[model samples]
Target: MPPPLTTTTTTFLLLITASLLLTITTSQDSDPDSDCTNKWIHIRQLPPQFNLDLLTNCSEYPLYDNFCPYTSNHGLGQKTHNNSHSWYRTDPFMLELIFHRRILEYPCLTSDPNLAKAIYLPYYSGIDSIKYLFGPEYNFSSQHGLDLFHYLSKTDTPSIWKRNFGHDHFLVMARPAWDFSQPISNDPPLFGTSFLELPQFFNVTALTLESRAYPWQEQAIPYPTSFHPPNLAYLESWINRVRRSRRNTLMLFVGGGGISANPNIRRSIRLECENSTSLSTHETGYGKLCEFVDCSNGICEHDPIKFMKPMLQASFCLQPPGDTPTRRSTFDGFLSGCIPVFFEEMSGKRQYNWHLPEAEYGEFSVFIPKEDVVFKGVRIVDVLMSIPRVEVRRMREKVLEMMPRVMYRKHGSSLGLRSKKDAFDIAIEETLQKIKSRVEEFAAQ
Candidate 1:
């Protein structure tokens, strides 16, 4: 049986009291004669910003669907809910910039000359021509793709049909590389190893399997919404984290971040529920869901935020990054007061990944290494299973405390991309930096 919802308010109140108690108890225990400057600072003087109003929403994006009570369910290979357009067109400039940068960073162009020359063939095509090469498979409806094609094609045209198309210049050398069907085959031939082999050719390669973390995202984009309007109101059922725990119902968050697709991390999460019967999947894969949340025909009213709140109500939120550590699961889980158990160093070494949002993890997020979960010496499931009920409750409280600021509408907060630059500036900086550094290195030689 699930924990009673009646205990929610009490749990919330107790959490507030605990924070006060912790501060008071710590001060009383401190050495009065000690030089305070070198000691830990008291909580009161630390920062006024920590005082939290737990009633606010945690999602940066507001709901764009006109309908409510969206419950959608479809079997494998079918979307599990009503496909909302809101997640289709959120940030245009950022997407375009990322794509542009990616094209410029093509691996073949940077590392192999002949292969790079062969691949750069598409970019030289007429604007209309290149647009068609992208094909319909790309998320063209998204704000990013929308802006990209607008710049590539004139006056809203969507095809590359009118443009001159040829593969002969570079293709003759690249055709062997296209045989990706046989991974065991030898590496394709190249004219030279020089970084500038095809110096002028630019095209983004297909995202590797590892890069495509959010494979299920048919249309995972955000749409524009008025900054945090005053009308937002939703009931938050505060509950003791321990008392709220449920069995078998595995909470899952499939987002872009720390746990997305590292083989080790992915392997660990599977280990946790290796024996359990409860089943849950977060919006886009990671988050908490309310008892009422479900989908019908690829459509559901599962706003990532609202969905997370209820997910906390469950036993677990299975969180894996959509692509890397910068995935939105951190923001979603932290905002909804759900405990996010993670795999270690999700963003540490992978090149070209973004950073996780700034938030205290010890109190809300859980990090474990693959070694701890895999094999007989250590099991992630065993460690997770052993965590006491009371401890989990405390973690949940920490999550709830930060909910308001995590909401997408909250301007300038860590989770929000308030201005146009907030969304795309970092990507732009990285892109230009790489281009400049690469060009200079080649020139120097």
Candidate 2:
């Protein structure tokens, strides 16, 4: 205070202050709460044909009623309310649009490719395929598919492609992997185009709702459900409600009869439920505390609260393969905190590794093999009743804890809303880790 400071000293002090401020800012940015906030993701801005054009004419799709309006609100579709709380009810097949919208608004998204951890190609492959698959011109699906490949092969910057042959790039599709990766043998004609078989997708990763055994590059993500809670408060409230609610039914099966190719496990379970008798004094018969909703007959409800009410009231929800091994209802059951009972191994265990805990099978769910249920004379009621009450409670708790991870929140909303990671957050984190590991392996090679 006695003497005037020199210019060099003042400059040094300012630099020190700046360094400290930067350190604080960086620490805040790197906090676990801010995990996805600072992540570096590069989205490939394609021509309008790939994404925007498809959305512009969304009504042309066969399921336009379900597709058009829902594409708005960031692919969250229409906002719905339950118990006086607001939430978005989304379409399972609208994930392509939802993911694209989210990535564009993601804080991690960077226009500069040099600072990116991984590249994303935001093509609405799912809806695009739908446009051609259900259109007047069916074979034109192949042409639509070709245009995407051609653009990637010829027009998109060669530098990115040449760098790693697309191993670091990824695409998200709402449809099953098999839809796009149809077997070359046209003995049984497939519905969608074979865009996945193109050379452009060789090393590229595909995030789809259902992944086939072939093409090791596929990653299965959860299908979008009706409930998309905006913040931790809403999610917590829902979890608490499910936790406090009384489960009057022991087990429930809410699907239609299966196709001829695949024996209908739901039908067998329904028969068991229909035959079970309530326990009075000494013995228990089948179907004591069981309920069934035959979706085939339009008896099943689609309203979020009405649908989840039954699932939440049941101890376990029977999840059989619906047309495919995976069903969006599996996630719906999970969202309602209903422990799932799987007949097929691939239905849950083999899928959702990124989002689910890597615990043992019986830890969170029950697996009665389809063979046991069909031919081995194993009764579904008997199998469920065998589990101890304590074990059932443990499984339900595990399911409740997993609710946040399975949900997809609104895109570009406050990061504060993500104190608990949602499905999108987990996907982005896991994708980055996978890309890093793969890049390291490539470098080693």
Q: Estimate candidate 2's alpha-carbon lDDT, on a 0 to 1 scale.
A: 0.71
**Per-model TM-score on C-alpha atoms:** 0.35, 0.84
Q: What is every candidate's alpha-carbon RMSD to the true fold?
A: 20.7, 11.5
lDDT of 1 by residue, 1-445 (tens): 3233223323333543554455445545555454422222111111111111111111111322211111111000112234521122112112221222222322112222221212221221111111222333122212212222333334322122112111111101111111111122224421111111121122222211122223211111211111121112211222234235443333554432233355455544444444332434432222322122332222322344435446555544545442234334444455445666665444212322422233455666566665555444464444555667678667666656644343323211232223213212333333334333444544566
Q: Once superposed on the true structure, which residue ranges of model 2 sit more than 4 Å away at CA?
A: 1-38, 62-66, 81-85, 140-144, 185-188, 258-263, 277-288, 297-302, 412-414
**What TM value does model 2 have?**
0.84
User: By summed lDDT, which 10 consecutive residues of candidate 2 come out lowest?
Assistant: 279-288
Q: Model 2, residue 26: what's the lDDT?
A: 50
Query: What are the per-residue Cα lDDT tens digits for candidate 2 across 71-91?
Result: 656567667653534456677
> Given candidate 1, what's the lDDT at residue 29?
57
Best by TM-score: 2
| For model 1, the run of ten residues with the poorest summed lDDT | 68-77
